[model samples]
Target: MKKFLAAAVFSCFSLSLFANSFSEEMLNIYAKLSVRFVLMSTLKDELSESVNICIGSKAEDERAATTLIDLMHEHYPAGIGEYKIYVIKSDYSNINFCKEASLFFVLSIEDIDLPKVITFAQENKILTMSYDQVLVEDGIDISLFIGREIRPYISLANIFAKDIYLDNVLLRVSKIYKKQEE
Candidate 1:
């Protein structure tokens, strides 16, 4: 019984460490993406006073949104009036707001109509990002993942399809994906 108890405690400690590492990675990704948006906007001559980020998530995923918001605030303190993060329910009515956003991070596409969201983003020049590779494959602009290392998978097709212009420096660092020639 003592041995079992000790093993359980060790397992819990290991799990917590893994969770902390994941959280830290997520925070770093968000910070990098925020900076990328600012730089992209500047390159496009659309530099604004504040970068608007619209987070789309279902009601059940509110906790994830809250965590991301907290990280964003921590990384970008109030004194820096450079970015604003807004959490919005994934709904048709909020499409306009999403279109106006500088960047849209979809927390979960399960409850949302992803094609519609993508179409709106493409039409409005809003960059879309997700942690899901499936979404990236479906033409989302960027996907943040950790496979031995943290990196971004960028879709060149999606980027060029949009009206916005991304700097070549950003392009060179990312893993660019282009559609196969049929």
Candidate 2:
């Protein structure tokens, strides 16, 4: 109907106003900001003096993960707040490696069972984020989109189910993803 058409057009227009491109610099900035939104209580016991991040990708490819790590180190040489940033590349085969991380960030990956990663993160209370917004639709907790400005695309339901809550400030600025009811 006319309402549906109007809504769709408005949605597209709103997206147009925001940045839709990807850059490692912007992604690193937003990714760091994303962690700041996690309540201290949620991470108090899980993290010590460091904020561990697992950069996950396919077994054969680690280019994106490496680039992200490089960018993170270059940008945040002193780390974020009181916690130092510790990053490791994960192929998702060694669950123990990822278990030590507070955040699991999905890179460019294919042919891997991603739901299993989500399940693992939920069980472990780890925040799951992705480089691709499309993965947010697939249930990754958060992804950043940038063109004119930085915007976080998030799955609140997914993060909430894992008992991972983001600050209201982030929720206010983010584009939350909701699955279409079938």
lDDT of 2 by residue, 88-126 (tens): 898777656788778888875564568788888888888
Best by lDDT: 2
Per TM-score, the best of the predicted structures is: 2
Candidate 1 lDDT (Cα, whole model)? Answer: 0.62
List TM-score per model, in order: 0.73, 0.76
The weakest ten consecutive residues by lDDT in model 2 span 13-22
The stretch of ten residues in a row with the least summed lDDT in candidate 1 is 13-22
lDDT of 1 by residue, 84-123 (tens): 4443434444768766577777766663478877888887
Candidate 1: stretches off by over 4 Å: 1-24, 41-44, 79-93, 180-182
- Provide the lDDT at 44 for model 1: 32
